[model samples]
Target: MPADDGERGAAALAQMRAMTADICDVIPLTAEDDFRITTATMMIGNALLVDSRVTDLEYDRTPAHIARGGLDHFHVTLCIEGEMWFSSGRRDVMVRAGDICLLDMGPPNRTVLRGGGGRTHLRAIILQRAMLAPRLAHPDAATAILLPAQHPHARLLANHFAALMLPPAPEAGSAEVTIEAIADIAAAAAGGTADIAAGVERAERHLYLAVIKRRIADNLETDALTVDELCRHFQISRATLYRLFETDGGLAHYVREQRLNLAFRQLISPAARETRLIDMAVNMRFSSDSTFIRAFRRKFGLTPGELRELADRWLRETGAVPAIDTVLHQLARRRKS
Candidate 1:
């Protein structure tokens, strides 16, 4: 349900607003019809995916009742940063942050997201039922109702998704990979085995690595950060550091890629419009502009000027931009799938 600009975009926004309004109303009323569950009393981020709306709904819970929708989308609610009780026809569950529940769209179901002085905030990702139907062919899909709050994969997906939604990007070049892995996890949640692997502890370690990688991105301009230095800063052992970057060709190679990505962003950002190439290279912690140019070309198959020109041309082509973004997002999702 993606649309073009002007009236189409406005109409889409209005539709999403109305859908969220109904969702909010259904969340707190005692599973009844006359409650007129009006007003979202919440915010629905990611509103651009108008065909798909993700909303936050919270209020005092009364008696539980079945909620129905005209739209054919399954609501996969991850108890992200909160507490909730969810029940399908055959399964009832209590969820915390890191936990997830899939509300079956085709069946009668009930859920009460707890919220009060002692209760925490509840958040969930709502997926269109049709968008989810393709993956539900597996018999195990229904059993794979909710991911636990402490499961490593669940935590990883939650943290990565939040970071992608946040301002600063992760420092690691493999962030795209991490994000893909998260999407894969989401897909798996929609269809994989119900029981999480026993290696949840190990997955937790990878989440730590993700946070560390973000820290590295933040310190990209600081030339003094070395393997030993980073180890000391993070209180991680040298062996652990090596393991964290093992999939990315170890610490040095990983760091180089981080620098390169930042350099690429800088080469095209407004900040670099007035800066000299040599100065920009140095500011990105590159040793020399010549080396930077060589590396950039080797990685991107284009010189800085060429790449900038390409980027500018892309900006001028409005129709192509959204297509590119969609392709990139799909590729990222496929990687995890």
Candidate 2:
């Protein structure tokens, strides 16, 4: 049973934004604009089925929003009417009527929805990260990707989610089973095993590693971003943390590399020139400027000043375009290895 808000127009948009923010942080395009919106949501066990119809709008989860707290869930959206475009990191996908899309809420994502002279209607099933963790490997890889409704497993999951949103929804016990089934099907569609017991331990390990890396990236600017703090936050033993990053030259090395890379980006940015090197180092929790510079030079074969000079020369010669795709690809490869 979808619970609809009685408010109309702008008020309805405001209500929708508030309700959505409760589930996950989003900057709703309709929040400040005049838009006709009608929305409803129903909870089935740990899953939330959202039904929405609104004017042209977009929802953005910015880096700042992700720094605050990323959404710990995945959205399986089934387009009922109109179309929507979803973008995250290096992937961009558009889904139309009868199409299905998977969106990982943990990453910075943007969704542009258009009404096409009428309200754009959609049904989205939001699944908690824990629910899908056991069945899928590298679940984040499935994010911002489209699963055409025609695919066998995708069709199955889509039909199941649609059925769950219908009147006289499944009983509590049945809903649990249905939700598990949906996850299993989604896992198979995502190139994971359908059997939960098969490779589940490895899947869980991957999920934990992914979560830890995301947490570390989000808190890189804070002085509290240490291995010990991560252990406490994730309730894992120190040995486990070391084991997780052993292939990446240990946890400390990984964090240092990330911080250095962040600083390198900041150094190359024209707007960041006003930010002092020592201040940036302190913000990144580096003990001192000398230590930070040494680490940065060791990683990139050049000091921060040298890199910034090279960046400026390149920008002057060819404009300020960065090879973003190359960077993303390198990051993806690093994550995989």
Among all candidates shown, the one with the greatest lDDT: 2
**Tens digit of lDDT per residue, candidate 1, span 130-168?**
444444445324532677766655555555545544455
* Runs in model 2 lying further than 4 Å from the true structure: 1-6, 18-34, 167-173, 193-337
Clashing pairs in 2: none
Clashes of 1: 6
**Candidate models: Cα lDDT each:** 0.53, 0.70
TM-score each candidate.
0.49, 0.51
- Model 1 scores what on Cα lDDT? 0.53
Error of 1 at 11 (Å): 22
